[model samples]
Target chain A: MILVFCELKDGQIRKPSAEALSEGRRLADASGKKVGALFAGASCAGAAEAAKFGADVILTAEGATLASYSSDAFAQLLADAVKAKGATVLLAAATAVGKDVLPRAAARLGAGYASDVTGLSMADGKLQAVRPVYAGKAFATTTFASAVQTATTRPNVFPAAEKAGAGAVETLAAPAGDFKSVVKEILAKAGGKVDLSEANVIVSGGRGMKDGANFKILEELADALGGVVGASRAAVDAGWGLPHSMQVGQTGKVVSPTLYIACGISGAIQHIAGMSGSKFIVAINKDPEAPIFKLANYGIVGDLFEVVPELTKAAKAMGIGSN
Target chain B: MKILVALKQVPDTETKIKVAADGKSLDPADVKWITSPYDEYALEEAIRLKEGKGAEVVALSVGGDTAKDVLKNALALGADSAVLLKGDGQGDAFAVAQMIAAYAKDKGFDLILCGNKGLGGDNAAMGPMLAELLGIAQANVIVKLELGEGTFKAEREIEGGSEIVEGALPAVITAQKGLNEPRYASLKGIMAAKKKTIEELDAAAVTAGAQVSALALPPERPAGRLLQGDASQQAQALLQALKDEAKVF
Candidate 1:
């Protein structure tokens, strides 16, 4: 059997969870095995969603201890689930929580694991995964030598296919485990800012924005277009925006937005590596030769200070919002 | 407190990667190697902890002779010592983590630090894997951290927010980019680093559990079509393209 760890957020299943489920279903079909899903949370209200993505059996672990994410506890629960189900292959979305818990679980099971994988397939009855290395500059096909194999798929790289399944839900007792480190509190973004990784549209600024003050203009553009604001490493290093969360680059968040607007950002290779997967790119800068133009579907070689406000006005006139 | 920072050397971010004749590896002829950018933040945080609480910082890397240069750079940046786990630099993350965990097992260090992920492999597995192997607490993608007696508090960046997590001593923490500003090596520090020796260990100590069967570059994106005309005209044309061509809006 193959098990997929379906991730939930705000009482709903995340997009990446569906993607993982779809991929898991594909792998199971190829290997002639059943695909089981494990959902650990206080509430499994959205557990049925996993079925739409081809989860045969949904294993729900609901308890006070599972209310909040604890790496140690989750790892223990997942290890137990894998053992109980006799799962030969395990998959999860390579989200923040998955990245934290998967490795620990793999260690517990003594399984070979790979994270942020983009491709999954079965070769000679063995699980194989294609993962990006060198920050997406190259790819490597990896095979686990262990009996139980595990991998996490990067979000937005895989399409989530909707297929009807049995959708049977089973409640499992939360695995009893000791926790050393716990999440004390979660400080959310102040203004309901869309997450850079999940945002469909992103407007990014770089050092060319001159200083922190100019970021307000980019913010205005983002607001007008119902998009989120992001900063390149140069802008983040210069303290031009939210240094911790809003930065998007190789060292920061890897985003695959539907539309990416680069304003006054020189296209550094590192920055491009993060946003290169966007469906459409538009670059606006004063330097005509800025490398960003090379990657942009539409390039505006002009002063961003003038072009951005006009673009914002145009977007506002078109009434684009959260579409 | 004794702090050990795991470091890695990667090609310069600007280096254009070229696949070797073997079709399985990168051609190293024109690649420029430097300490992984995120690792510098780990080194900086270690140095800062040392400055605040009289600790010894030891930098460690798992690679060949070229990796020694990264350790030397760490030494120049204020690490008291460095160690190189000698290898061909082709081992998987599990093997590398096991080797480091083995070396650190007996060492009575209170803290371990590393980049959230190495640019070379883009594998964010080592730190957490190492922590699990050592049976200790760990926090990854940490943007802010404060160390206390036998415990530490860290704020890790998540998708839409940050989480404040508390872990006990002997914990492993991976440094995010904004954790701290890495300092440059001064002339005095460079001279001192030149005199420092880097310890080496054979990679045969640990075995790999996973192997790479093949490697290839991702398909190149098609060249973009640049719009013509002035800024206003370009903006108008862009809106049109977004609507008619890309259909993203």
Candidate 2:
């Protein structure tokens, strides 16, 4: 069986986890294997969605220990689930939680892991994973040498597919863990804003944004485009009160948006690596020589203060990104 | 208190990459290696702890001879000693963790530190894997950490916000970007670091769980175009291009 760690947020299946489960479904089809979607918590409520993604078996690992999010406990739960099912492969979306817990589970299972993988396929009964390396300049094709293989797919790189499945639900016994670490509290952000990792289009700012107040214009543009606002490392580190979640760079989030509109961003290699995978790039800068112009398919060498409002008006008129 | 900081050297973040003739790895000839920036934060945190509370900070790295440069830098940055686990640098994160776990198993270190991830591979797996292999608890990508007698309160970065986690001593904490600003090696420290004897040790034979079959550059983007005329004209052309040529939104 190919097991997917179907991550959930607020009892709903995260969009990226759906993509991972669908990837598992594809691999299972290729290999004539069963696809199992495993959700860990005090109790799970999203098995139906998992089934839509082709989970032949919905496995739930539940207990009070898992009521709250804890990487230590979750890793133990995943390792136990993989063992109980006698699964040979494990898959997940490379979100913050997936990246945190999957490796620890791999350690327990002695599984070889490829992280932040952008591509996956079954080749001669083995899993071949492709991941971006060297700040997205190169891609490496890696394969697991261990019996149990694990990989986490990058968000937005894989599309989710839905198909009917048996949808048999099974409750997994939670592992008793004297957990080493526990999350005491989570300081949550305000709701309704799109997450940068999943946004199809991004309007990003940099030091050229001048100050945090300047970001309001970018936010207005982003809202019109049905996208999110992102920031370069320089802007994020400038102590402008920009949340690090919106940071796009080597040290921050690596995003693959469909349209990346870089405003006031001078295209540092660090920032470039994160957003280089965007399908189309647009640069708005007063200086024509900014490195960002080289990557942008459309460039406007003019002041952003004037150009941005006009662009927002145009995008709104076009109904861009609005479903 | 004794803290061991594990460092991995990667190609400098700015270097343009070329695949080697082997088709499975980077071309070493053109690559200039530097200590992964995140690991520098790990080393910096350890040094700060040493300065605040008397402690022994040992720097550990796994790689071939070129990796020694990273260890020397760590020494100059105030690590009391350094150890190089000599290997061919062909191992994956799991193999490296196995070696480090073996070395640290019996040591009476109160804590261990490493970067959340290496830059080149961008696999943020080693620290957690190492902690699991050593049978200890771990906190990863931590931006803030407070150590107590036998416990720690660490704030780690998640997607939307921060989560504060608490763990006991003898735990592994991986450093994130905001952990601390790493200090540069002073001239006096650099000279002293040069004279300091680095403990070289043969690494245990470990098996790599993954192997790279081929390496290739991502498809190059088509050459970009500069919009002509004034800002209004440029915006108009850009929207047209998006609708006709790019077709993105």
Candidate 3:
């Protein structure tokens, strides 16, 4: 059997979980095995959603101990589940939580593991995966040599399929393990800022924004467009952004937003490595010679202080992002 | 307190990577090597902890002699000592983690640090895998950290926000960017580093669990069609393109 770990956020199944399920289904079909899903948390409210993406069985573990993410606990639970199901292949989305838990679980099981895989296939009853290395500059095809194969797929890479399955949910007791670290508190970002990795639209600033206060203009524009505000490493290094979480560059979050607007940002190769995957790019800068113009779908050579407000007014008048 | 920081050397991010004739590796002819950027953050954090709490910082790396450069750089940046796990072949994450864990097992360290992920592999497997092998707790991708007596509080970035986590001593942490600003090596520090000797050890023999069959570059994106007009006209055109062509808005 092949197993996929379905991740949940606030009791709802995430998109990446569905994608992993779809990939799991493909792999299972190729290997002539059944595809199963494991959902462990305080609640397994979205087991049905996993079925929609082609999970034959949904294994759930719910208890107070499983309410929050603890690496040791989750790894133990996953290792137990893999053993109980006799799963030969395991998959999960390569999110922060998944990346933290999967490697530990693989280590416990003594299984071959790969991370951030973009392509997966089964050949001769063995798993093959392709993952980006060197920050997406190159791809490497890897084949597992252990008895059990495990990998975590990168988010937004695979298309989720809505092929319904039985999705029979089975509740299992949470595995007991030693827990040394625990989450004390989760501090949610104010203003409901979308995560840079998952945002559909992103407006980013750089050192040309001058200072921290000037970022307010970019934030306003982002809010008006129903997008999130991002910063180049230069802006973050210059202390123009409060948290480094908003940074978008090679050393920061790699984003592939649908629309990425570069405001007053000079495009460094590191920065380009992160956002070059955006479907559409817009560059607004005072320097026409800025490297950002080379990658932008639209370029405006003007003072961003003036150009940005004008663009914001135009977007507002057109009801561009009232949603 | 004694801290161990795991470091790796990688090709400079800006270098034009050319796939070697072997079809599974980069051509090493003209590649410029530097310490992984994120590892610098780990090294810097260790130096800060050493300065603040009278800790001894030891930097470690796994590779051939080229990796010695990274340890030397770490020494120049204020690490008290450095060690190189002498290995010339590529090992999967599991093998690499096992080697490091074996070396760290007998060493009494209060904390272990590494980059969240190395730029060369982008695997993000070493730290957590090492933690598992050592049977210790870990805080991955931590941006802010506060260490106390045998305890630590770390803040890690998640999807929509950050979470504050607490772990006890002998914990492993993978440093994220922005954890600290890495300091430059001064003349005095460089001179001192030149005099310091880097300890070399043989890596435990382990078979690679994963085999790489091929290496290829991603398909290049088509050149963007630049819009022509004033700022307002360009904005209007972009909006139209979003609605009509991209269908994103």
| Strongest candidate by lDDT | 2
Tens digit of per-residue lDDT, candidate 2, span B1-249: 999999998988778888888898888887889999999999999999999987999999998888999999999989999999997544488888888998999998889999999988888999999999988889999999999988999999877677898989899999998888899999999998998878999887876777788999999788888888876777778888988888775
Pairs that clash in candidate 2: none
**Candidates' lDDT values, in order?**
0.85, 0.88, 0.85
- For candidate 3, lDDT tens digit of each residue in A26-72? 88888899999999887788676788888899999988778778887
Model 1 regions more than 4 Å off: A239-244, B229-232
DockQ of 3: 0.65
Predicted candidate 1: interface RMSD? Answer: 1.9
**Candidate 1 lDDT, tens digit per residue, A215-262?**
899899889888889998888887555565777877778888889999
Give stretches of model 2 more than 4 Å off: A190-192, A237-245, B240-247
lDDT at residue A301 of model 1 (Cα atoms): 82
lDDT string, candidate 1, B181-221, tens digits: 78999999999999999999886465555777778877767
Candidate 3 or 2, higher DockQ: 2
Cα deviation of B249, candidate 2, in Å: 3.3
Worst 10 residues of 1 chain A by lDDT: A238-247
